[model samples]
Target: MAIYSCFLGKNLKHLKIRLHDIKLATHNFSDKYKTESNGHTTWYTTELSHFNKEKPSLVVIKHFLPGEKDDEEELFLTELEMLTSVKHHNIVTLIGFCVEGFDMMLVIEKFSNGFLRDYLGNVKNMRTLTWEKRLKICIDVAQALNYLHSEMEDKKIIIHTTLHNSSLGLDENWGAKIEDFQWAIFLPPNNKDGAMSKITYSNHSYYMDPEYAKTGMLKRESDVYSFGVILFEILCGRHADDQIYLNGSEKGLIHVARRKFHTGKIEDMIDPTLKEEIGRKSYVPNRGATKDSFYTFLEVAHQCVAEVQDQRPTMKVVLKELQKALFLQVSQLYILS
Candidate 1:
């Protein structure tokens, strides 16, 4: 085994966890303690010792293979940079990390509700995620995007190249959050450089901009495109997959939703659960709350997924639009009740 040590300055020493702590918490990484696995990394439900007392802690421990190439190490550093730079609630919290010799590890908070992929269009949890919960989740995700794409104090753009449903996790209360930032890139402001820099990376074929994928060019709009897919999840309760979009003559959710929306049948795409809710409930002071709110949402989502990048709205604009629809739906549901 390669001997190693982690060096942290006084300011960061508190976050520097010793190897023994990890061992004690995870029982030496025994499979019995493992709760989840993704490729090479594994998640463990363990208790961390804080101030001499053990507290329940849910974390995912990412193990990097020994002797990574230069580029791999650089990518690790970039991920760390992005994690430490962010302090938003809608983004999963970075508990800490470990760097000992050739071995590396990352520890992040584990969400209780798991990924959105678990519920949207899935038989197990679909019924549990009612319309209100789904709407709240959409708002929560929008806030996260607004922070990443618009609220950076350094004026640099942090682009998450992939934003599939699996990358979105929910907390105990169903508050949605963005969990993975491994593919993120920091770029100078677009106006300063005419256009944002390109990311020569890709993953999970479902959600992305065609131009960004083909040209290695990345922009804030790339995330908008992915967010648009997420909006479809909220609207239709569908998950991202080629088959879901390619069902019948539909090329994608955007294509199908666009046609349904233009023809005034957008409600047809709503999940049966929500469809039932809207049909049975006459709580809206007016009959069109469900229709109006759903149309507003579909319109915004359709605009975000526009084939032309220039046609897509900024993250800030998307957030406000979502907020408006959320408020309308929430208010009508309560008052019209």
Candidate 2:
């Protein structure tokens, strides 16, 4: 109660924005301003008029469609509260929110590169990321998770229930930020085993933690499992829900990836574009991962998607391993130059 009250008075008041101003900025949520809508939520990009800066500032507007008023309102408030409480360089910045009338909108700083999910699959609309950039992006997300899990001002741990591709966004410099926190939960530091009984479920089983699915308990390690999926997605250049992974008997990237790893055929799973970079013999230095770095990343990623929750490493360990992998790649580049 104290935690909620403190933020409600000190933060929410200053962060609240009027509905009229948002209407003006988004031109009444015009199609021209709308970037995307996935049925439940619509995203828009516009320069907020009330800011009144010399240069127009771009911001992302998330309009949560109220299907059943009570449920949608709860989700909106959960997201708002989570965003207001958490702060990190690798987490999306919440600028303001409007909750007047039927409108439930959150205004956030717009990232230049957009969602990480956009760059996945065979889509040529987005630029391909170098292995170096991918490693850095993973590191950024790992850092954010570590912060949420251990570094909160209140001695509470946050479990980001839905940590999939869509939950991650990339900035102008390809830096990654974590978003979409409506499903996140907080647990007291003294909670047994740092886990809580699950209250909700996600349909995306590909990213959902197996232990949580089976036992109805959600642990901080659940996020580690999901992050592991993202790591494999980056390495294999495919989404967890991709049709290719779904059609096979193995089903899902985690199953197929682990099988390949055990059979000593893990190299088959590396993205061809990355393979090209790795195999290149040019004297000029490039951004592809060296064998040592690739193996380091692969081993940790493999460990992350382990079936047993206890088998997975903590976010802190994941961050340390990713940093070491990046260092190995960069040091090799220096030697080559």
| Candidate with the greatest lDDT versus the true structure | 2
Task: List clashing residue pairs in candidate 1.
Answer: 283-336
- TM-scores, all candidates, are 0.86, 0.92
Candidate 2 residue lDDT tens string, 61-142: 9998878546666667778888988989999999888877677888998999888788888636223687788899999999
- How does each model score on lDDT? 0.71, 0.83
**Superposition-based RMSD of candidate 2 using all C-alpha atoms, in angstroms:** 2.7
What are the per-residue Cα lDDT tens digits for candidate 1 across 79-116? Answer: 66678778888988878777766556677777888888
Alpha-carbon error at 318 in model 2, in Å? Answer: 0.6
- Misplaced by over 4 Å in model 2 are 1-7, 123-127, 192-203, 277-284
Give the distance in Å from residue 333's predicted Cα in candidate 1 to where it truly belongs: 2.2
Give lDDT for model 2: 0.83
Clashes of each: 1, 0
